[model samples]
Target: MVLNELGARINTALQALSREAVIDERAVDALLREICGALLESDVNVRLVHTLRQNVKKRVDLDELAASSNKRKVVQSAVFDELCRLVDPGVQPWKPQRGKQNVVMFVGLQGSGKTTSCTKLAAYYKRKGLKVGLVCADTFRAGAFDQLKQNASRAHIPYYGSYTEPDPVRIAVDGVAQFRASKFDLIIVDTSGRHKQEAELFAEMEQIAAAIKPHNTIFVMDGTIGQAADAQARAFKQSADIGSIIITKMDGHAKGGGAISAVAATGSPIEFIGTGEHIHDLDAFSARSFVSKMLGLGDIGGLVETVKDMQLEKNEDMMKNLAKGVFTLKDMRDQLQSILKMGPLSKIMGMVPGMSPEMMQGFDADESTRRLRSYMCVFDSMTEAELNSDGKPFENESRLRRVARGSGVRPVEIQALLHQHRQFGQLVKKMGGPKGMLGKMNPAMMQQMAKNPAAAANPANMLKQMGGMGGMQKMIQQMGGMSGVQNMMKQMMGGGGGGGGMQEMMAQMMGGGGGGMQNMMAQMMGGRR
Candidate 1:
């Protein structure tokens, strides 16, 4: 629902195909046709859709997929993988150590959300404990300084700009110097939204880039631009060493697919996405999750981890309740709190499988939160006996009336809550019993499940579920827990796992003994049970 129209079209296309297995070539061909039609309808680049269809056909021909019984699943997986590659070829790492005080410059036309994105990036880095500074070099806009300054103040980062300094290059140079003087770790340069055809303005951008020597140049495009993204990307790339792409206003756009495919076609990786107007609405671009969501194969893992991370203080308690198969209205309230922490419901649910932009079109975050809160109030009005003994409340109409009156909601709404609670309770019971998929999992697997419940719920486990010992260690570090296991893993893995390989490096940082490192090494070799 985050990108409603596109999401709906994609879901409809994927629904036409089965994820089990297909023996008929005709069915596979038909499925490909549907997929192509859907992508085209979503305003995806024509050439890219053709390439995707061809790749899907080629993969099917190679028989590299699952066995006959699992053909559908294999083909679906192939399609998802290919789609992800089409949008983002791979992860674009930002190496702070490789460059001196990484400077990222944001460029876009006016009203494309450049200033807001700069603020979001600053906030994101600040949350990571990095010292960040912002520069408002958009002198062409009358109020650009005040606008960016307000955002910088909100983010609590140092901002450099002068209404009197008419030269953008000088402002940029001074901003960099100021950040350097303050010992900031990251500096972001925000430029005016200039038309690509304006030679004078383009020359100014080049001068600013040269004066400051930014480590990365990001082209911020409005998702509403749709097919125009190709031209915009080409224009920016001509003037600067564009290192990354950011698509803004994604939540309101119907043609975001075009922006994504267009940038990817230009050989630039999408680094981040803006889902809404809020500073916290930006998310790191994840190709796999995007593709999976587009295909309607729920993204349970992301939802779960987001929920867990958002409710750090309540995680252990929530997990215990989950294990006990008890999901009350109170539990639902806690779940709502966790969801709120992650962001809007429609946006969060958009990550779930089968949720389309169309489905999310009219689904507002504030309205959903209001309804959920109302439902909780209705539940709270019920008597203890009515809540503890589920069947008795449902059997008595008088009790329902009492609850409706107490909560100041309609009786029908109260009944609806009861009905929903019953269904949720049943689902929890199933998840906790032996017949439940989660119940059958081992401890290590359970830990993984708990860490990324959203991933676990995904119909296609396309997104990597971050769990196991490594995930646990990361979670611990993130939650301010003990760092022992993280350090041990770093020593064992030698940090070459790249960003992930630092588990063992963390062990050395913790001053652990060599014997402890040996034990961690054993775990890496699958020696530990």
Candidate 2:
């Protein structure tokens, strides 16, 4: 949701076009004007905005699209592609090898979160099974070594830094040699940064590069720097070979269009973006996925990777039960637990088509965390028999009341928890049944589908297996289709809680009364890329 204002304006413009009864050149012009204005206001270069406008106009031919069923969708798709183009450097960033030492050098102006990003990247690679070490060569700034030492210690990553070593070039050389001798696969060298680009900083950077050759040089840029990012990035690019860029403070309320598009214009691919101060908040950057999330459109592949990273697939019992079309209370509890491990609920929930991370806007994240823990407490209060069985064991009113008392929650709250669990259980049963899409396909194929969406490009056949197209249409009609989705987004954008939307959407997908995940997905993908 970085650059949320820009996204909201563009979304509003698109929504207005969708509501229009007529589609013409004038309407198209109006849409582009609104979108272009949003980008310009978000610190994007005027020239880049102009170029995007020209590209959109070229792509969206009203005359050719006149006969199309959905003129709005055509324009929207064109705009989405152009937005992606605006931020894509079109170059692959460097990747670290697992069995060999890979030295990654970090450089940026002071206060750009360069030191923090070093730890973040190191932690990321470490999480992926790499032997990572941190080398603090940032001796120009006072307490730089201590900062790196504290961060590396906190992340449990090995570190090499010297308080007495004033020569950064020598320190960098020694650190890299030591880590390489230690057989660390990924050695991160945190170089010194200055308040501004200067001869001293450039000289130091060059000397360090000469001493300890780095495989990748990452330029860390501050998101709040606006259009100045281009000058900063270009200056650094001139001094050193910037293999990639990482934009920090994207979680703030700053307009990130400048830092993102400006750096991309420099031909330096943005490999990662720092979403928060947390070590795990550094997310791999993907132009298309970034645009999708900005527009509140989900990223299924990203969601799969998150689940995979949490190692949720290691539960053999759950897999076996799922294959047999069984979903016990224990399985639901495990999912909730896995969700907790996945970090904030809003973030993970946004991967669904209709949900946005801002759906819980103005809703305290701690409150959401507390809510999930409360449900876990209810699960813990249950006996082993209740945990292993379906909701049948909790049908007795006394049993439900007793469990609620044990968890210190209201009886109705316990019932609501049970309802949510049962819904999840039912959806899992249908999806993992012998007749279900998951059961019918192998794990490798499912993984392929997640990685390459084109594999499941034609979801009609997949939908038919779950039910029929007619069922899908009927379900969407019941939920009012995009009307319902738009309303939900409006509430979220207004900084209000939109849990009602989530519950209603999930209920429809669960087919607790009607609809199903199959029906919902096909309807959601009707106009999606």
Candidate 3:
């Protein structure tokens, strides 16, 4: 299992305690056992796992707890904090100063994904408004310059490399001098990777480091290598003074925990994680945020940064309407478009409280994108009044049929889309419409609020300011009480809810008319029913 699966297992163990009348020593021991098993299975160092278990046991003494303290809360907090610390090397990551030429050299073993990471890092800085350049110095690998050229072309980053340059040291020195003279703020040099840690590779790296004198030397480690990454990373660090680490291929089925913990154990801070092969897949590493999301506790800082990057002010008109509880079909279409700009739905969902990667896997981003486009097509077939109207414009069967015919879709889909729009309106109203939880939040406060468990997990507190405890109780009852809420959350968290009640609530929660997100995904995919 990967780290995600490990986290889910640990989360289940911790959540099981919520059912207990009182958390006892037995319950605590059971929780630790489950966690230990999960970490060990994910290839975490056995000694580290043992230390984690011992630390949790020492901190979670049921007998020593005060009567007023919540045993479950304290125990869970301790586990979460410890998990964060396990992957953190306690070293500051290297930062490139703005307007300064920063040459970052990449070193790793063969197939560790060092070259691609070089382009990804360059793209990352380029997107941040930096003048970035890439240098292909991997003379050892056949077609290495060609690969770097292609990647750099896609990222639109300037590059320097020579097919005839047999010496990597000369290429590294020349590329750095050229880009530095051109005033590129972030210049990245891609070094050759060997099949193993060889003397030749180290000598080459030493020569390149001396020539370029890079501001930061990053070692890219393959996440699938597990605990073996420690020895590899330490060897590279010994060779060229590695300033940071980047773990690649995290999108694969690798047990990434061992790779991460191993690298951290080598005293190198993880600077970024390559989640996918896409140029935009690089994510800045944060131990706290990563572990928080792993435990189904959302990464608010990441979400906030994505939204800010989108410049939400550009959607001011739509925001104003949403605040007033006016969610027309057009507004829904607009929101979906904005979500596309924010990146993959699975990634966005992973940043939501209680939403896990396991749950988010249900959403196919391409299909979701297609479905959103199809919804826009249906909207396009409608009259302007119908599109702008806050009322149900598709209530008439004739109008629905006409839309279906025009958009090349089934009538049922149009109906589902309209129903989803109304649910969104209802959800907005239930939360006090305009001036409610979402509308009232500034980006910074929104992140801080998500970190508070009471704010993120409790619907009652979220709605308390809107309608008080009485209204909150009434709403909870409408959703079939606390048990119903838990069931819905389980399905939402990818816990496999097959019950009719759970499905119905999930459908409603998704605001997908009568269908749930899965149904919407299927419709978008347009595959076998």
Candidate 4:
């Protein structure tokens, strides 16, 4: 879970007042004070914080509405809306023009993830069914061409670069011409990153941009740079016509606030966010989703859709079964398959509300999947009676050995699977049951839990009161409701959930779950139990 420190603080202040039954002038003032403190702590510009506080105070002062059951919700929604408006102001979504090749040039300083981002962007467009070509024009860096070439091969996109060609401008000009002749729908030029003081290299970038004449120029920056982003953006903006910005490495540090908020301050719209190191780890930027994640409101819609597109119908059906309290080894197999479709487990987990980049960094995706797959194979060898039983039907060691032998796996793998199943079952009971647990979680606490899946299934002391199960139910319903869930399901199913096959096929491929096709079929069947 990427913590939105600034958003979390505002939500916390608002939650304090919601607990009270009566709205007093002093209570509102105190809440505003806390909000101010939180914003400052998050490194939000003092002027922005002051403006936000003034807006909040004005809303509080003008309201004659007494503290009713819904008063807290109303105020909270208002604050959330205002904060979103202040941060994003509802800019039009970015869409690369269709039916023609689009050229995108990446500009940033060294180690800002420009080369990696280029590969990722190519992968992103390739998955969209576009013929993407990569121009590794960053010839100055060691192994820059090799790195980009390797990534392009992995993504199955064409690459153009030369280790021997010392002139980057010539390489870029020729690369674009070659790709154009090949009729590629998109061409990405990965330029050499230099410090702001490198006038020679900056001039080279200008020359390359002019020669290539790219339709879009994206400025990539490390999110951890904080206020330094303003200077970097200014430098890039001055040298070239930068159309958009891509903020990389936002999964760590509190500086995501500074990078994103700085866009508004510096007068540029965010184009994309690099959430991880993988070529498939890029996501389209959405201010609403970003703000919601920051404030501890779980992105239920995003999660469901991401899952639907990446996982097989079998996988999704199995998850829906788990959601409805049905746990089976077949279901477990489907879940593992879904995880595989979703790419790395750690990456998928990071998209959840409270899971931080640090927590995800510790777990190796391949190792976890290998272990889970081994466990599933063990389960496959089980007898029907054992498979359908509530508890381990084969209680004896001899039976475990026989089952493991049949599955050609270790007996310990079976034990591990059982242990995982028990843990997961406990989690489902806590999250789904009326009074099991997760029943008392507040917005901030829920946000934290979203970041930490282990905590998501457990009850916390911070949210012990305030209407318990009923309040949780209301919160869940409000996040997206059943219709929102369905729409997300459609997105996950890719285009197959609606329209014709081509659209559906495109959606499934880009959705990221290896199971897009199967998910489409399941959705067409009405996403039933």
lDDT of 2 by residue, 250-360 (tens): 874447888976565569888998888878778788888878877777655565555556554345555556545677878777766666666554555555554544564
Residues 1-529, candidate 1, lDDT per residue (tens digit)? 3355555565565556755244467777877787678677767788889999888888776355445346666666777777787787565745455234778888887789999999998987776567889999999988999999998897788899998989999999999898988878899999989877988999999999989888888888888787777777788888888888888888746677778765664577888889887777887777776665555544544554443334243244444455456655555545544444556555565544333344434444575557656755766786666554544455678877777788898876665555555655674575454544345556664665467553333322311222346643443454244334334432323222212112112211111111221222223322111
- Candidate 3 C-alpha error for residue 148, in Å: 2.8
Superposition error at 26 for model 4 (Å) = 3.0
Who wins the lDDT comparison?
2
Model 1: lowest-lDDT 10 consecutive positions:
508-517
- Selected candidate, larger lDDT, 3 vs 4: 3
**TM-scores for all candidates?**
0.66, 0.81, 0.76, 0.69
Estimate the lDDT of model 4.
0.63
Candidate with more favorable, higher lDDT: 2 or 4: 2
For model 2, the stretches where C-alpha displacement exceeds 4 angstroms are: 61-71, 252-254, 356-358, 374-386, 391-415, 431-529
Which candidate would rank higher by TM-score, 2 or 4? 2
Candidates' RMSD to native: 13.0, 5.8, 8.1, 12.1
Q: Determine which window of 10 residues in candidate 4 has minimal summed lDDT.
A: 495-504
Those runs of model 1 whose alpha carbons end farther than 4 Å from true positions after fitting are 19-25, 62-69, 95-100, 155-157, 308-338, 354-364, 371-529
- Per-residue alpha-carbon lDDT of model 4 for 86-198, expressed as tens digits? 55735563467778878888899899999989988888776666888999899789999999989888878899999799999999999999999998888999999987899
Evaluated at residue 364, the lDDT of candidate 4 is 54
